[model samples]
Target chain A: MDLTVTGLSVRLGKRAVLHDISATLRPGRVTAILGANGSGKTTLVRALAGLAPGEVRLGSARVDTLDPRERARTIGYLPQDGAVHWDVTVESLVELGRMPHRAPFAGLSAEDHIAISHALAATDTEELAGRLVAELSGGERARVLLARVLAGRPAWLLADEPLASLDPAHQLGLLDRLRALAGEGMGVVIVLHDLIQAARAADDVLLLREGRVVAFAPVAEALSPDNLRAAFGVEVMQVRDEAGRILPVPIGTNR
Target chain B: MKRSTLILGLTALVALLFLGSLMAGKAWVPPSAWFTADPRWWIVAELRLPRAILGLGVGAALGLTGAVLQGFLRNPLADPSVVGVSSCAALGAVGAIVLLSASTPLIIFGSAMLAAAGGMALLAGLAWRSRSAVAFILAGTVLASLAGALTAFVISIAPNPYATAEIIDWIMGSLTDRSFSEVQFAMPFIAMGCVALLFTGRALDALTLGEDAARSLGIRLRRTQMLIVVGAGLAVGASVAVTGVVGFVGLIVPHLLRPLTGARPSALLLPSALGGAALVLAADSLVRLGPGATEIRLGVAMALIGTPFFFALLLRMRRSAWI
Candidate 1:
C-alpha cells in the first residue's frame, strides 16, 4: 500500500501547526521525516494517521473521509512516550491491538490469536508475554508497544519520535525490526531527529522546515547539505567512512 | 488473585452480606420466621428486603460509576462523591426539600438528576479546557466542596424543623425504611448506566495507552467521554435521589479491586460493582447493629470504614506511583 498526503493542514486553536504538506510514502520502504523542534513533524504524522483534522489520502481512499475503524484497520500509529498505564501482561496488552477487528461483544477469534502470536514473534517479545509491561526496561516496553501496533496488522505504520529515548544499540535493533517490517511490504513512516540514523536507515527521507515540506526524495538525494542547513538552520557536512559511504553530520547551528 | 476467582468471590460475598443484611436489625429475626406467616416475616419482606435491595443497587451504581470516572478522567482518585456529583445531587434534593412544602419523590428525583447532570457538565468543561489529571482532581475537589457547602446552607435555612431533620438524615446517606418504590425507580437507570459503562471497557483499555494512541486505534474520545459522564450521572444521580450521598463506596471499591484485577480498568468494573454492593450491605448491617436508639447512618459507617483504606491506598499509590 502507498500512503499519500496532499494539502494537509492543521491549526491548534489559532496558531497554524502544519500547512499544505504533501508527500508519497511507498510500501516496502522506511521513510524518515526529519525536522527541528516545533517543525510540525509530529503534526504531519498525526494528520496522516487521522488523529488531527487534516486531509490525507491513502492510495485511492481519502484518509480523513474514512471511518475511524477503517482508518485504524489501514494504519497503525505509535505516539511518543507510548506509556502503558496499567501492570497488564504483555500478551494482554498486545491483544488490545485486535480491538478494531473484533466485535465489541465477541471474544478473540482464532485469526486474532494468530495475529497476536505473529506480532509477539515479530517484535521478539514472546519471551516477555507473561510478564507485566511495567516490569520491562524502557527499550523492552517500546518493543512490546511496537508489538501491540503490529498485532493490528495494518498496511502502514506511522510513528512519532519512536527512537527518541532508546540507546544506540536498542535503536539499531528497533530500526532493524522496522526494516524487516518494510521488507515484508509494510510501509513504515517515522519521525526522527538524528540525521545520522536517518542517513543510515531511511530508504526515503522527508525534510520539513516550519510547517512545510522542504525535501521529499530518496535518502541519498534528499539529505543534501543545503537542504539540511535550510531545514535545521545548522551547518551539515558529508564525510566518507572507511566503507566509502557518504554520511551526513551536523556540526552546529548558526545562531 | 485470578480474575474468575475474584469475580466469584465478590459475587458470593455480596450474596452472603445481602442475606445477613436481611436477617440483621435492631432485633434478630430468625430464619424460621422467613418461612412462616409471622410478623417478623412481614418485617423482613416489607422493610429489610427493600432496604437490602436498595443497598445492592446503590452500592453497585456507586462502584461502577467510580471505576468509569477514574478511567474517563484517567485519575485513580476520581469518584462520584469526590468529583461532586453525589454532593451536587444531595444539594439538589435538599434544595427541593427546603423550597417545596411536602415535595414529592418525583420532584426530588428530577432535581437530583438535573444537579448531577450540571455537575458532570462542569467537570467535562473543565476536562476539555485542561487534560491534565491533576487539574481534574483539583477541579473535582473544588466542586465537591462547593456542593457540600451548598447542601449545608440549604439545611440551615430549611423552612421547617421536619425538613431540616429529613435533610440531615438524607445527607448522611441511609437505606432505612426505604420501600420497593425507590428500588423500582433506581433500578432502570442503574442498569442502563452499568450497561453503558461496560460497553466502554475496550475503549477504556485503549485509553491506558493515552488519548492520542487511543484515538489512533479508532477509539473516539468524545463518544467514550459522553458515555462515561452520562452513564455515571444517571446511575449516581438516581442512587443519591433514593439514598443521599453514599460516600466512599465508589472510592474504596475500585481501589481495592484494581490489584486483584491486574490493574486493568475494564476488568475491574464487575468485581468493583460486586464488591461495592457487598461493602454497602456490610456497612448497612453495621449501622443496624450499632447500639443506639437512632440508627447510625449508612454513609457515616462507610466513611468510618473507608477513610483508613483511602489513606492506605494513597500511601501505596505514593510508594508505587500507581495514581
Candidate 2:
C-alpha cells in the first residue's frame, strides 16, 4: 500500500515549517528525502509518520485516524537524536520496539524473539546484545538504535538523519539493510545530508528547499545539476565512480 | 542478581520487618502473645498493627511513586515530594488544624486529598501544553515553592502556642498512636494509587527512548503524565494526610533497587515498591526501639538517613560524570 500526503501544512509554535506538501510514497521502494538545513526534512518525515499534524493516508485509510498501536505497528519512526535515557542492555533496548505488538502485562512471545534476533543480526549488533547501551561507542549506539526500530518489523520505516554518527562501512551496510527491507515489500524513507549516498542508495529522491519540494523524482532527475543548485544553492561536479555510478561532489556555493 | 530473586528477597524482607515492627515497641509483646491470650495482645492488635500497616502502605506508595516519577521525567532525583503534591497536601492538613481547629482524621484527610487534587490539576494545566519533562519539573518546582511558602504563612499566624506546637509536631511526621481508622482511611487511596502506577510501567519503559520515540512506539504521553500525577497525588496525599510527611522512602528505595532490577523502569517498579515497604517498616520499628524517652519522628529519621545518602549519591554521580 502506498502512503499518500495531500495539502499537509505544519506549524511549530508560530512558525510554519511545512506548507501544503503532497506526495505518494510507494511500498517496496527506498525514498531518500534530501534537503539543506531547515528545509523541513525532519518535519516532513515526522508528518508522514503521524508524529506531526498532517493529512496523511495509508492506501485508503487515513493514517491519522488509525489506532495508535496499529499506526505504531505499521510505521516505525527513528528520530534524529537517538537518545536512550537508561543504561539498559542492547537486547533489552531492542525489545522495546516490540512494545506495540505485545499486551501490557504479557511476556514476550516466540514471534517477538525471532524478530529481535533478526534485527540484531541485520544491524550487526549481535555482539553488543548483552552490553549496556551507555557503554557502546557512537557508531555502535546508532546501529543499536536502528536495530530497535527494525525489531518492530513495521510495514514502513521512517528514519531522520540515521547516518549522522555512522562510519562509512556501517553507512553502506545500513543502506544495504534498508534496500533488503524494501525488497521484502516494506516502504523505507530516510532523511540524508550526503547527496552521494542518497543517489547511490535511493530508488526515489525528494529534494526540499525552504520547506518546499524542489523536485520529487527518480535519482537521475532529482539530483540533476539544476535541481541540486536550486535546492541546496550548491554547484556539484558530477564524477562517475568505478561502478559507473554518478557521485555529485559540491564544488562551490551557487549563491 | 536476577529480577525475580531480588523481588522475592525484598518481599521476604518486608514480611520480616512487618513482624518485627509489631514486637519492637516500649512493651515487647512476644509472638506467643497472640496464641496465649496475653493481656498485651491489645497493644499488638490495637496499637502496633495499625502503625505497621501504615508504614508498609505509605512506604510502598512513596517507593512506587518515586520510581514512576523518576522514569517519567528521566531524572533520577525525581521523588514523590518533587512534584509538590505532598507539600500541597501538607498545607491542606496544616490549614485544617490552624484554621478550622479540627484535629479529626476525616477532616484532615479530606482537606489534604482535595489540595493534592488541586495541585495535580494545576500542574497539568501549567505543563500540559509544553508536553516536555523539563516543563513539568519546572512547574512542579514552582508549585512546591508556592505551597511551602503558604504553609509557612499559615504557621506564622497560628491562633495559639499549643496549636503551633501541635502543627510543628505533626509536620515532623510519625506513625505513632495511629488507630485502625487511620489505616482504613489511607489504605484505599494508597492501593488505588499503586494500581494506577503499576499500569504506567510499560509507558515508562517506552520513555527510556525519549519523548518522540516513546510516542512513536504507541505510548500516549498525556495518559502517562496523567497516571503519574494522579497516582503520586493520591498516594502521597493520603500518606501525608495520615502520618504528616514521611520523607525519602520513595527516593532512596528506587535508587537502591535500580541496579538490582537492571535499570529498566518497568522492572524497577515492583522491586521499588517492596523495597520501600521494607525500608519504612525497619525505620519505623527502629524509631520505636530507640533509647530516647520521646521517640524520634519517622520524618526526622528519614531525613537524618536520607541527607547523607543523598549527598553520597550526588558525590558518586559527580565522579561518574552522571550529573
Candidate 3:
C-alpha cells in the first residue's frame, strides 16, 4: 500500500520542531530516516505511523480510507521504548500485534496463530519465546520487539531504531530479515543513527533535519558527505574497495 | 490441572466463608429457619448475607480499582485511598449526618458516595494534566491529607462529643451495628460500581504497556482515561459509602497478584477483585476474633494487618527483583 504525507508541520508549544515536511513511503524497500539527536527523525517516523498529533494529509486512495483499526491491521508500528508493566511471555507479547485485526472479546483465529508463530521464527527468537520480557538482555529485548512488529504481518513496518542496541551479528541478521520482509512486498521504514548501517540496510534513504526532509532517494546519492554535513555538521571522507561502493569515513581526530 | 475445577474450588471456598459469615452472627436461627422462618429469617437473608456479600463486593472493588490505578498511573504506591476517594466519601457521609440530617443509612451511604466522587474528580484532573502516574499519585496524597485534616477538623467542632466518638469509629470504618437496612441500601451501588470497573479491563491492559504504546495501538488517550476515571470512581465511591473508609485493600491486593497474572490489566482485574475479597474477609474475621464491644475500628483493623502485609510484599519483590 502506498502512503503519502503532505505539507506536514509540528509545533511543540511555541517552537516549530518540524517544518512543512512531506514524503512518500515507497514499497518493497527500506527507507531510513537519518539525522542527529533532536533532528526530527523520531517525529517523522511517529507521524507516518499516525501516532503524532499534528497536521497530516494522507492520500485519497483506498488504503487511506481504511479505518484506524484497519490501518493498524496493515501498518505495523514499533514505538521508541514501548511501555510494559509486567512480565508476559514472548509469545503472548507478539500476539498483541493481532489485536487490531481481530474483534474485541474474540480469541485469535488459526491464521492469527500462524502469523504469530511465523514472526517468532523469522526473528530467530523461537528459542527465547517462552521467556519473560523483563528477564531478557537488552539485545534479546530488541529481538523480541522485532518479533512483535513482524507478528502483525503488516504491509508496512515502521520501527524507531529497531537495531539501536544490537551486537554486530544480530544487527546484520535483523537488517537482512527486515530486507526479506520488504522482499515480500512489505514497506519498511526505520529511524537510524548509524549512517553506515542505514546505507547497508535500506534500499533508499530519507534524511531529515529539524523535522524537514533533506533527501529522499537512493542510498548511493543521498548518503553524500555534503548532505551529511549540511544536516549534522559532520565531515566525512568517502572510501571504497574494488566494488565501487562508498564507505563512511569520519573526519577530525576526535578519536 | 483443570481450569474449571480450580474455579469451582475457589467458588466453594468463597461459599463456605460466606455461609459461615451468615450463621456465625450474634443472633441465632434454628436449622428449620433456614427454610421456614418468617420475617426473623431476615437476619441471614437480609442482614448477614448481604453484609458478607458486601465484604466480598467491596473487597473486589478496592482490589480491582487499586490495580487499575497503579497500572494506569504506573506507580507502585498508587493505592486508591491515597487519592482521597475514601475521605471524600467520609466527608459526604459526615455532611449527610451533621448537615442534611438524613436518615441513618442515607447519611452513611449518600455522603460516602459524594465524598468519593469529589476525591476522584480531583484525581482525574491531575491525571489529565500530565498523564504522569507519580504526579497524579502525589496529587492524590496531597488531596487525601487535606481531606483527612478536614475530617479531623469537622469532628473537633461536632455538637455531641459522644456522637463524635461514634463518628470517629465510622470514619475509621465498620460493619458494627449494621442491620439488613444498611446491607439492602448499599447493594445496588456496589453492584453497579463493580460492573463499571470491569469495562476498564481492556483499557487497563492496553495501558499496562504504557501511554505511547497504547496510543500506537489505536486506543485514544482521552477515551481510556475517561473509562478509568468513571469505573474507579463508581466502584470506590460505592465501597466507601457503605463501609466508611477501609484502607490498603486496593494497595495490597494487586501487589500480591500481579506476578501470577503477568501484569496484563485484563487478567489482573478479576483476580485482584477476588483476591481483595479474600483479603478483606480474612481481615474482618481477624477483627471479629478480637476482644470487646469497642470493636477495633475497621480502618485501624485493616491498617494493623495491612502494614505488615505491605512490608512482606516489598521484601518478596526485593527477592524476585527482575519482574
TM-score for chain A, candidates 1 onward in order: 0.94, 0.98, 0.92
Predicted structure with the largest lDDT when compared to the true one: 2
Candidate 2 lDDT over residue span A93-115, tens digit each: 99999999999989999999999
Per-residue accuracy of model 1 over A120-220 as CA lDDT, tens digit each: 98777899999988788877888889889999999999988878667788788889889988999999999999998888888999999889888999988
What lDDT tens digits, residue by residue, belong to model 3 across residues B48-152?
666677787778789888887776776666777766677777877776666665547866686777777777788788767665556666777877788888877
Error of model 2, residue A229, in angstroms: 1.0
Error of 2 at B169 (Å): 1.0
lDDT per residue, candidate 3, A1-255, as tens digits?
A: 567777778777898878888777777989988987898877777777776655443445433334667667667888778656667777777877777777766778998899888988888889887788888888888888778778778888989988878898999899999999899999999988887788788888888877777788898788898888777878888887355677666684222
TM-score of chain B of each: 0.91, 0.98, 0.86
Pick the winner on TM-score between candidates 1 and 2. 2
**lDDT (Cα, tens digit) per residue for candidate 2, span B44-160:** 999999999999999999999999999999988889888999899999989999999979889988888888889989998988887578988999999999999999999999999
Error of 1 at B117 (Å): 3.9
Better of 1 and 3 by TM-score: 1
- What residue runs in model 1 are displaced by over 4 Å at the alpha carbon? A240-245, B118-146
Candidate ranking (DockQ, best to worst): 2, 1, 3
Return the clash pairs for model 1, or none: none
Which predicted model would earn the best TM-score? 2
Candidate 2 or 1, higher DockQ: 2
